[model samples]
Target: MPASGSVSVQSLDQFLAEVEGRAFQIARIATGCDQDALDIVQESMISLVTSYSDKCESNWKPLFYRILQNRITDFHRRKTLTGKIFAWIGLKKADEEDIDLLEQIADPNADMPELALSKDRFSDALIHALEQLPARQQQTFLLRIWEGLSVKETAEAMQCGEGSVKTHLSRATQTLRAHLEPHYFSGDHHES
Candidate 1:
């Protein structure tokens, strides 16, 4: 292989390695299941490597995120379809295990029980608010706020116009604020 080709491969590997953990977290939040999140991240990584490895390095972040979003959408669609089928078949489905939101927080030493409880409450409220958002709003908020994408980049990732991204973000923020305001500002961090 040419030296340039080798360099590109190395760069791609490093990029994937660095983003994999956060991508998994994003997928986990979107899917609400550990195994499904793992599958989505794996599939997104493979899709990016197979289809978009040749793109410019600067373009990789948005592209990878776009792919991840698509994978999450696909996962949700499959889940819904399967659920409908199961209902029609009169079959009982097993309950899904709960995923710990605080596990995603980067705290290697969680020695303080009070701090841990506070974080747990915040994480629960945040997750509930996020899950209540409309799909487009959730996508826009996650890409723009959580991932720190520009409006243009977020629009590109969601395959929408910049105005649409902004509108969705505005609605998402409003809804989140309404849902979380009481819990956030009431000074009730302790889980009673």
Candidate 2:
């Protein structure tokens, strides 16, 4: 209806706005700390706006995710290196800040009674299972399943081959099933 360039820009703006919340959530999952997640998401947003704004709208999803993934990986790398150095110098503390499992679990609930309780359990189990997965598998599962990206789009976002994405997704799904089946499918409140 409008000029093509104007339409493209408008769509891009809409796309970014829609994805921003999800991107922050994804970054938060990747980074255990809230502050780190916020920083990573902000940097990724800036990078995407500056470098990839000219990209086709169709290609923006994968590009934005790839940038987010790179930022997450960079944060992990820096943290790992800093920890190593601190350990080498005997400056690292014996007890690090423990992430509370219950607190980390998202409560996807409202004032509803039965639905809230059941869904909360599932959400907790899902987040725990996801946290146990390797970084690549976690990324693949989140991109492919949670985000509903195609295998090709996931591959691009992960900077890997399609086969690799499939492999990682398969492994992640199997691991999640193993972790969740006893509690969910069996109807048993097995304490892990």
Candidate 3:
């Protein structure tokens, strides 16, 4: 086929191949459902191709991350609003179980035994503890610590001040520490 534009299909394929896994990881954490996460990633890919394909390649990472985060936040807002409306209509109970945000934010691959071999019960507890964190805190923790993004990059992706990023990360750390204190510092815990 004749070339239609300056941005070649090869370049787009390369970009998608490089970032697809991490994009899915971020979406999974943000949405808590694998299928929803996949949808967000796919949508983000479409948006990137449609709107920003002509931009310089160096700008792709932040632009993609920003789009992904916005999509995730929108999904959460819609879900929350719908739940509230349902409750108001007496179609759902107000006392329904709260979602574990931290568990939602954790990378699914991290659950593998190669990373940590905690008993199934301990792993389940940890997932529960993570789910209890606020959305921003969980995002901060995952982007900064898990994805290894710098503070500035994380702030940009989150569309927040650096101070806000630090605050969220600090609060997330404290909450996780408190939740894991008994296991983390106990004598039974072995240092690798």
Candidate 4:
């Protein structure tokens, strides 16, 4: 409440708590690896706090997303590089299959478990469609539509021009529409 950049500790903490869940969702979608997504989200939060916490509350969304976007990009880069190096070395990286017992059998809170499993038909379809999109398109759609960032704010967060943001969103929308409309309008929404 002091100024844009210099928010009180409580305010900043509140902001992080509010955004963390959505950030994790976005990161999970982008990375397709839970542990990597967790690391990226945690690193992004730390980055926003260490580097830009003084920005106004209004500015925090774009700033935080900018950090998130960068972290995700770095992750993709590292993944690509690792894949290349392993291929060059003639070693196939084994998929991670060691599951923790707690993680496997833990009972999350009731609503959390239900909400995670029981997406409505449309919600499930939308998430499926979203997963098929390319990374930039997915990021653009999520930031602009899902996250409710304006064109300008999305541009700032994405480190791209507004025109680029518009192009990405338009392409993503078209793809999602093409992918979802048929399924949605079909007999998929009714209960037996």
TM-score for each of the candidates: 0.86, 0.84, 0.73, 0.84
**lDDT of candidate 2 over 8-41, digit per residue (tens):** 6677779878877777767777877667777887
Instruction: Give every collision pair in model 2.
Output: none
Poorly placed runs, candidate 1 (over 4 Å)? 5-7, 101-104, 107-116, 190-192
Model 1: how far residue 82 lies from native, Å: 1.2
Among these predictions, the greatest lDDT belongs to 1
Say which prediction, candidate 2 or candidate 3, comes out ahead on lDDT: 2
Q: Model 4 shows how many backbone clashes?
A: 5
TM-score of 3: 0.73
Error of 4 at 30 (Å): 0.2
Q: Please give the RMSD to the true structure for each candidate, in Å.
A: 2.7, 4.0, 5.4, 5.0
* Model 1 accuracy (lDDT, Cα): 0.85
Model 4: ten consecutive residues of lowest lDDT: 98-107
List the candidate 4 regions with Cα displacement exceeding 4 Å: 1-5, 97-119
Clashing pairs in 3: 100-131, 101-131, 102-130, 102-131, 103-130, 103-131
Model 1, 139-179: lDDT tens digits are 89988998899999998989999999989999999999999
What is candidate 1's CA lDDT for residue 105? 56
- Best of the candidates, TM-score: 1
Error of 2 at 48 (Å): 0.7
> Which 10 successive residues of model 1 have the least lDDT summed?
100-109
Least lDDT summed over 10 consecutive residues: which range in candidate 3?
96-105
